[model samples]
Target chain A: MAAHRKRTKGTVVVDTVGIVGLGLIGGSLARRLAQRGIRVVAWNHRPHPYAQAEADGIFCKSTLAELMTAEPDVLVLCNPLKAMPAILAELKPLLDEHPATTLTDVGSVKGMVRNQVKAAGLADKYVGAHPMAGNELSGWQAADPGLYDDALWAVTVDEPTDYRRFFAVASLITEGVGNRIIVLDDETHDKAAAMISHMPHVVSTALINELTANPDRNVAAALAAGCWRDMTRVALTDPDRTRAMVEEDALNVEVLLRRMASRLTDMADQLHAEQDQGSIVRGGSLKGDAAAHIRKFFAAGDPFRRYKAQTSSAGDFPARELEIPEAGWQQTLLFSARRGEAITSFIHPHQAVIQIRPAI
Target chain B: MAAHRKRTKGTVVVDTVGIVGLGLIGGSLARRLAQRGIRVVAWNHRPHPYAQAEADGIFCKSTLAELMTAEPDVLVLCNPLKAMPAILAELKPLLDEHPATTLTDVGSVKGMVRNQVKAAGLADKYVGAHPMAGNELSGWQAADPGLYDDALWAVTVDEPTDYRRFFAVASLITEGVGNRIIVLDDETHDKAAAMISHMPHVVSTALINELTANPDRNVAAALAAGCWRDMTRVALTDPDRTRAMVEEDALNVEVLLRRMASRLTDMADQLHAEQDQGSIVRGGSLKGDAAAHIRKFFAAGDPFRRYKAQTSSAGDFPARELEIPEAGWQQTLLFSARRGEAITSFIHPHQAVIQIRPAI
Candidate 1:
């Protein structure tokens, strides 16, 4: 194993990576890994992308058995989440035959995928990861290695998770794929994913729905500018895809939506009160309870604004090493993530080089 | 007046235009008009930009009295909305002296500006125009002539608005600036502005505020991608500026925010019910009241999605002439705008060449 491993500044823990489903995300990953001089073996549901993928220096396999013959250190399930149960069932026996290969997946919802893996009796070999990448485009035709450039991934682990398996997957992301990562439990990953992506997609959809229902929709559409365009961009994508993603993480999205709805309602009340007391207010300043509340609402996000400004102005964030404690190492990395530290690479199994980024 | 106007394909109704407050919108308009060979006279609160503007062939005036002395066909008040009352007060006596100079402003909210113009006894000379252009940038230094390229201007009018004044401003937008015009009444303009821009700005701010208040904020921020960035872009701008914009159209914004809140809440309920019935549902095909409601919500915006697709694919929208009726001309043009027609040029005061755009 040591003789087969290649050495960069840090040891390349994942010398060979196997990828399933050569769609946008998977295809892009395969090409990127191959570009990075890592041996990549890929299999798609259909062989259409195989010829083009092989042309990019990736080894194309016809079956799961053949892919397993290559002895990939990390096998990524990049198939659609709907295909999870069937694929997991098929991979169960093959993975059992080669127990040394650590399993991982690039599914957006972590807990559900973990559950599926558990149901397939492959929990011991699995580590969950979701790259914060992709665009409005899909399919092998739209795949590009640049899609993973400067991407951050959330690596999910749990209490019963094997440290060796976790190290293998984390090192693959940080060193093999040359991407940053933050450790999280399945719940934290799914909830955070819901907060940032799924909930926002639903909100965007609601906005377009509101516009479509308006009597003067054409007038509103004509007057739409940067704000309207940016806020509703995600809604303009394939609704069926968005609907599936939202439904997959339905519980987390539901909670965030209610919170967002409450926030909007509170703002509406403040605005209403301000209008009612319009006669008393002078200039642009309102002098009432509603005015104070509105001022507070606007000021609440100042920390985030300042953090973004700092990040934009300060190029190349400062880096430091995080020592992963032997006991409860998952909690240590999660706490580091909460402090806005992103693990760039593993110097060794117990040590990680993290970049300290501006926090909200 | 006819002899002073320059002739292209259509009569340039406003040849010599007076501009006050040369900020982003004002400076861009001044430059674009000057580029088109229109005589532009400008007065700023300060003369910092005057030299460069003069080099661009704009006649810089030292005072409102001097700007009025230019005897411009149209006077555009482009100062900040906060300075509007003071500027209107100063312009009132000067405008009375030269009653032929039609007054207009590039304000976001038409109703409020109209009221300010009415308060100064200049409503009879006023027409409300809001160019659907601008960026996150501000000031004269950030201004460029190309900002007006392929832009839309909402020309707002009321029952008592003089035909010639409205025509002068509309023609100035359509002919002088070479842009499109959609005629609307003050209420409709304010409501639609709130719907597409103002209300969405608040929702975006709320989103950032929510993330800021989250316990796993750093985690979510780390996982943030295109959707989070796009939805929160407006919120990252000067909150004070966004607040002012929202407050100016307080009533309209309040109503729309409440509507958005209700929509979000409805979606939340559907998602919750869908999750509750997850056990009974097979494969991603949900069955229940929740499933039906969810499907309906996702499908509601299909018209808008289809309209966007059509507009993006079709190059160069079809154009035709629309004749204006003497009685209820305001309603006639409003109806034309409702039908998704944008006035490109006025062949005459009573006739407009409108482009047929895709509608929801």
Candidate 2:
């Protein structure tokens, strides 16, 4: 495996993609890439998904050994978080045989795999990517070819990413498979994943359980408002998949839950203190800094929403047909040219907004 | 006020409606009722909403006293929660004189107003109503004429309600305005409101605040999914209005928040213990009752969502233009018959579902 790293190329674009674990993410990506006329071979331990993919025109490599025999240019380990290291070990023989094969994974957390790969001295051959796109639904049955459409794919790599091969393979999946890309390191990716998806997922499930467990379950259901529905939508997620995510990200999730509990405790205490002081308390009795803090806290989510609207809204500029005003190359350049992600112009039309996304 | 409750009437139907507040709920109801050829007069402290409603062809009353001078058949207290009792006190003298007027209100909580009115011995003169419909937006600018259409209007009354007058006024607002009706007592209504609206509102704001306060806000925002948007929509609410709702429902909200926090704590503990046990956990590590509880917890919300689809979804039975099959009378009877809130049939579709809701 160590010797394999030395046999590198200038720029490598994977012709064949070998994906292990044909769940929603893997199956969906396989379908998308295969639709784009790329050769995609997948290996799943279960015969059902493998047979299903084969029937769906996906090349079926019966096992990891068979996948290695095909000499795929890129190998994606899409197995559960706990299973990646073992899969990497199984693929090591293949890596030693074909040094040109770039290794990557589509896992929620990156630190685990990155650390394992680095420790195994296979760092140069590995890249980690996560597509920030999913629904509460799960498995091959729920897979959609356009799942990654306009989705954000974060590629986690070392500071000096392997521009020649490793990064190139990840970019093929990120860009060629049709997604916007952002680059960061493993720790940042894990922390961000914890905040954005993993922990929020737990909170959502807990919120659901709490409300549903209440004595007023029937009443709560009857008055289920839009916000409540949206907040708890993820609660309807497939139990098996949610279990995987929770178990894998348990530590990060616990940290997050504790953090949230701490915040809630402080809030409850503040309200209680206000009540005790006869301060004519409301729901939350903060007249100054605490109120400001809460406001600021809520305001923080706005940027992300705005950013999503800019990137993922219908007829996103890149996909739209703008009548190039005959003399409009100037205006087109004004909008199409990356003015450092001017999100406002896109949302507010008076600003001559250009619907543009910065390059990865 | 006590003498006002003794006014005898063979039958009562409010031909004219006087609404005391002209914000979203009040204005929307006023416009809807007025559109149905019913006379409506609205009075608000703010001249803007008042002027706007008047200009919109709604009869404008200068004040509650002026509204009483008009000799309206029914009066709706559409004022804020904190102000409803005082307004009731202000209108007491008028209530004593205008014995024929049936008084009702559209407030989230029923206990406060109902109790205060009962204390004044004006119980028979008052009925409490809350329409389970709203958006994050507030004020007259956001009001829609069809806001009540396809909504659930919960009408709260005493155990021995004045069916002739009370039901007539409530029926006018619910059935005539094209909404489904549910009847409950003041305490029951308050408890249910806490379970559904108030606490969920706080949780939404808190969830937004928690996720935003994370150091990974930019990333979290970038990865935010539809659930995140729906969950946090309430975060964009007007501060003053939210403050009012929270203050008004503080005690109930505290109870709900504590319950949610309790469930969250148990979850965190279980996950922590599971991680400690290293039982090869997945999303959540509960193998016995803990696991069953979670599954049941998530399952409880499904019935509500299904019930909402049955009652609130478009063309929801009543709102639909069902071409009555000459032979479809039986199914229609099975559906439209007052069989006591057969929520199961709409959800399961297999049940012979009596469309019955219990009469007060």
Candidate 3:
């Protein structure tokens, strides 16, 4: 809470921050902090990303040693998952030299990263954070300074975390990005993420892959229109990354998929049941029963009738006497007969009845 | 096909046309045809739809008998599935009285309706058609005159179809609405629609329903940007209609769903295999493996790396010669190394990298 603000403020005043991997998040943070007159430096594994970062006037230290020498109050690890461990190892010596400086990571998952950091004996200085924001698009070039505006930044800390260091890190993240911050323990964060982010991707990807593999895909694709495209757009994101996420979180994802599978199986079973019922009604074999069920099911309700009822009120019309025109020998007249009348009807071309009173 | 247009020019003519059911399709057709100097008189089973149609300057007749008295050269049926049979029954007597007139329907399915018409001995006068166009939105109010512009219109006919009647119906349908026409038999048309139109709705709705049902949906919904919203918009369409469409076309829909289930199962199996392999290789579950896999699946090849490779000459920058700065005592240092070569390494706060690289 803001009650610990005073202690963290002093720490932040002494802290200069270093960010590794100047991708979308790291790059955006660098830009925003520099604009706010905060001294921020970044290191990217790729020279071009850093080259572009330097060209964009975001502060970039020529060397990591020089950055460490600047004595940053905090360090933000923004590199990809595969590279983060090596970078962390490389920073161990510097961290031992500057025990006062804190470190945090902006990775999507926290439990694994937190465990690794704890195993490295940097638990007091290291915090794991995730800013729940991103587009399907990636990279520093795609980064916008305003990307984190109004976003939620989840900050995770454990019993080993120094309260002072945690508050200092949380303040910087909230201040730099102007995002609302929520604090959770590492395990809670991972489980929550699996439910929120990880599961949806698996479901979406599976659906897209299924549709793609369908023999009738060409026709379905043409009819895809709005809904189909919207639902599967995420599937078109990095398929490799999606596969990795689902596979890594296989246990949780498997549970979710099982749930989905059950729901689908239930649906299929219900359809089969309905098919049997329809077959009994129509006196047809089970082989053709599904088709009959479908026919009757689709024809059950009038779509227009449903829409009209949903959108309109019966009171919208004024009451009037119902009229039926006389019928000629060659003309077949169509009319709704009232309870008391069985009248002959006649049809006219120009003077057509635009309103008919339903037989009471 | 246009090569024979000269010979068929005067052979086909469409003037006054009767349209039953003034919903989106019927209303749009009336407006478009009116613009093209074709007389269109339409009728709705309900009073308000007719009232609204009349308010929109569409000619609405009170009764089927009145509409038939117009002796329209062609009649267009645009009612819903359940209402179609009864409407057709009422229109039959009128049709028999005027044998010179032709009839066509703009229903979503053809086989069942065509079968019913055949049973009623009205095959000679009816040509089934479906326009592949719609928004998730529905009704006469949502109708746009340009709804059918440049859309595909599938026209189905059989041995009973009059050649002259077919030409006349096709001409009217293609005149200002669809760009091309696909002529098919009744069974093919229904099967194609089941694959394309109905199946997509089922899949899209299922995805939306799954997302909506998630316990962590609050965060997911909050994090849902343009991509999530765009993907699920169609789920907001009439649920009952979507359910009916899928249930009615259960055979086709079941086939599609089964295909999806298999793909999901394969993905899960692959993920489990990878986990087993990783556990054996690394002695325990690899930390961040899932996140890494997800990211990798979605990762495009890094653009900056591609750019650097493309722009650099062989001798430009020796990989081993590159020096990366180590974080000094207090500063947070971030750096990148690719294939054992240091890219850019720097400390945060004092140095920042900023520039624009065109996305390749």
Q: Which is the leading candidate under TM-score? A: 1
* Model 3 chain A: lowest-lDDT 10 consecutive positions: A337-346
Q: Candidate 3 residues A292-317, lDDT tens each?
A: 54444333323322323442455533
Worst 10 residues of 3 chain B by lDDT: B329-338
Off by over 4 Å in 3: A1-15, A50-52, A55-57, A186-188, A279-360, B1-12, B49-57, B157-166, B184-197, B207-215, B225-227, B279-360
Instruction: Compute the lDDT of residue B131 as modeled in candidate 1.
Output: 95
Could you report the Cα RMSD, in angstroms, for every candidate shown? 2.7, 10.7, 22.9
Instruction: Write candidate 1's Cα lDDT for B143-227 as tens digits.
Output: 8999999999999999998998888898888878889999999999999999999999999999999999999999999899999
Q: List TM-scores of chain B, every candidate.
A: 0.96, 0.76, 0.70
> How close is chain A of candidate 2 to the true chain A, as a TM-score?
0.73
Error of 3 at A261 (Å): 1.8
lDDT of 3 at A228: 51
Q: Which 10 consecutive residues of model 1 chain A have the lowest summed lDDT?
A: A1-10
Q: Cα lDDT of all candidates, in order?
A: 0.90, 0.63, 0.58
* Docking quality class, candidate 1: medium
Backbone clash total for model 2 is 12
Rank all candidate structures by their TM-score, best first, as comma-separated numbers.
1, 2, 3
Fnat by candidate, in order:
0.84, 0.34, 0.20
